[model samples]
Target: MKFDLHVHTRFSKDSDADIDAIILHAKKNGLDGFAVCDHDVTGGGPFSVQRAAELGSDLVIIPGVEISTSEGHLLVLGIKESIEPGLSPAETILRARAQDAVVILPHPFKLTSHGIGYIAGLDVDAVEVLNSRCLTDGPNNKACAAATSLGIAQVGGSDCHVPEMVGISYTEIDVQERSLDAVLDAIRQGKVRPGGGKTPKVFVMRQMMKNAQKRTAKILGLD
Candidate 1:
């Protein structure tokens, strides 16, 4: 099964993509499933799953969150409860593990994206080596190399904040079943491969500008 294990929805303060629109776009892009790892929130995932069911779509929506840990950002998939932000990476990972969630280090070398910078000694289940939002290949390459060296599973995601970017990058998982547990297990067991092209720089730039505008508007109380 192919899954874009990193994506954001309106639940993420920096994103405006609606769950419905995200689902349709993911289906159109030929993805089997996608994880909703909205920043600091897990509600988007279950909300997306429910929306998909309401739309009678078969795409699986794995519950997840993008945690803003002290070290950087981390992806926790198949989590039921929300993990608090600003905790240490180790603490965050420990909480996710307590929930039997799968932890992934995303853009671990992308300085501008709050990447964690180092991969050694982290107890993550996988590493995102093919983040579509990475305009340059250096970060992704470094992540891939690090994962390979550590014998850790490598995954991919669009890290999309917009609907159009859905499925730009995905993880090809070898799973016999289409359930959430099956997919998570596949990822944990290294039965996955990263695939897809980079997200167009123009789209990325546009989103960044929009985010900046929103922040500025909030600061000015004009939102």
Candidate 2:
């Protein structure tokens, strides 16, 4: 099945896109499922999931959070509470594990955040080898290498804040069911595949534009 595991909504400080808009974009793009992985918060999941159900879309809205760690950004899926950022990566993973959530490293080799190299020693469930926002091929390759060396499963996502970018990079999983447990099991069993690449210049430019937009919005008090 095709799934975009990383997404953001207005609940995230950096994104203004609401869940409904994101869902509509996903449905139009012909995605089978998507996850609403807001930063540090899973509050948007219930509403998004309910909306997806109403639309008669095969969309499986998985609840998740992208947590900021001292080392890097981590995607915690199947979470039901707000996780605070600024914790160590290890600690963050531990907490997520306690909740039976899947802990994944997002853009592990990116320059802005702590990469997999720093958190390799920590226990993690999966590695995001192909992040839509990862600008450099090096980091994406590095993520693949890390997952290969560690014998961990690899997953991918669009890391989309804008609705149009959803499914740009996606994960293909082999699972009998479409529930959260099935997805998590697919990751654990290495039954996942990454299906895209990103160029460094394009990635850097996109981040710059997004940052500029956010700054402009804040200055105008539009957020």
lDDT of 1 by residue, 119-143 (tens): 9999999999999998899999999
The 0-to-1 C-alpha lDDT of every candidate, in the order given, reads 0.94, 0.78
Candidate 1 overall lDDT versus native = 0.94
**Cα RMSDs of all predictions?**
0.8, 2.7
Candidate 2 residues lying further than 4 Å off, grouped into runs, are: 113-119, 199-207, 216-223
Deviation in Å, model 2, residue 109 alpha carbon: 0.9
Over 1-223, each residue of candidate 2 has an lDDT whose tens digit, in order, gives 8888888888887777777788888877767788788877778787788877787767888888888887668898888777799998888988898888878878887766456454367677778889877655788888889788888778888888777777878888888797878877777677888785443456547767888898999999996
Q: lDDT (0-100) at residue 128 of candidate 2?
A: 87
Q: Candidate 2 — worst ten consecutive residues by lDDT sum?
A: 196-205
- State which candidate has the highest lDDT: 1
- Please give each candidate's TM-score: 0.98, 0.87
TM-score of 1: 0.98
